[model samples]
Target: MSTGTLYLIPNTLGDGDEAALAYVLPAPVRERAGTLASYIGENAKTTRAFLKRVGTTRPIQEIEIHELNVNTPAGEIDKLLKPLLGGIDTGLVSEAGVPAVADPGALLVRRAHERGIKVVPLVGPSSILLALMASGLNGQSFAFHGYLPVDANERIKKLRELEQTSRKAKQTQIFIETPYRNKSMLDTLLSTCAPSTLVCVAADLTLPTETILSRAVSDWKKKPTPDLHKRPAIFLLLAH
Candidate 1:
């Protein structure tokens, strides 16, 4: 019997409105998303909402959603792929952006590859890639350090280290913070990075209020710090 494929689905960066969905995701991805009956996601509520927006024909209640998060045990991850082994195609989705890139879905993807199940990644909006495209940074060579330390002092130390690495390797550093902590993160970046270093703050990406600005750290200090509180954003920094 042929094993089922594991579809890596991508969701919107911010509000999953019709316009953003229509603009970033291709027609084929939406169509394929509708056909899946089982899925693994970071959050069930948001997963259902995204499925509805993608025009799923299946009844929302009937769709099977297995939760996968930081707390999910590594051993239990194999069970999440059992449906695929039974010849039922299953999708992996995140609360936002592409699944598995910076999300816990990567664990399931890795297990699928070990089991030799076909894995397919559908085209969708990714705040990281979108920010990099607009940041005009060293996209060819860059690194994504998911999230910095939450402690202010540690965060500052980490920021300085990332800046030093960027300068030494000429590699762009990309990172993010929880929406509620956005302002604090921005403050740390402004205070810690070198004055001449280039920094890009891409907020509310793929949304109507989307903003992408790249400027020298010195310039950012002169203007009012952007109000990023309670908003999703991607921060990019480069020493060159």
Candidate 2:
């Protein structure tokens, strides 16, 4: 009988390491920290810390760290995750929020399924679902378009297309961009979508000063917009 396990880990939202210990494994597994596997990014320090909280005193070798790339091919993802999938349990995590929801764990999960590996999803905060919950938009039918294009002209064209598609399909179009580019994306949406279009901006999600506001495209002119560079944000466009 071949027995292996993969634990999907979620990074704490906003709060620091105080709650991390609760998310780790028990004492003896904590003693086998080195045997644990970590599937996170190089810049994912908070996530790495959470894993260490579980592994405890385990040897570093047991603590395998698989560097995941959101843009990589499935074959490449399989190559990087071979060991964890073959014998050891793999832990998939995003820097924040649940893995595979606009995170890099989709390929891992799909590959694991193809290999007949058992998978488990843990409880955690997901910025997307949280935003949708608060946005007051149609949550039943929504699509996450991931990050938008950086090129201004192309972005406008794509937004126009999405606006039409969203309206016709009766689906909410959700997307995000780099924090620095958020303002520009907002501007494009305002200019591209119909004046009656409903747009929602969910900024600094899960933080102390979280903001989830939905308003008409024409009404957006009535209030001050987020500086975007000051904080991270996600945008949702709905047809109402």
Which candidate gets the maximum lDDT versus the true structure? 1
Model 1 lDDT per residue over 43-162, tens place? 899889899888887897899998999999999998998999999999898888899998888888989999999999999989899999999999899999999999888999899999
| TM-score (all chains, Cα) for each model | 0.96, 0.82
Residue 137 error for model 2, in Å?
A: 0.9
- The top-ranked prediction according to TM-score is 1
Per residue, candidate 2 scores C-alpha lDDT tens digits across 1-240 of 453566666655555453443443234433333345545452455556666554534654445576676566666866755665567666676776677778777877787787777877766677777778888888889899998788888898889888888899988888989877878888889888898889999987766677778999999977888667756688999864
Q: Which regions of candidate 1 fall more than 4 Å away from where they truly are?
A: none
Query: For model 1, which pairs clash?
Result: none
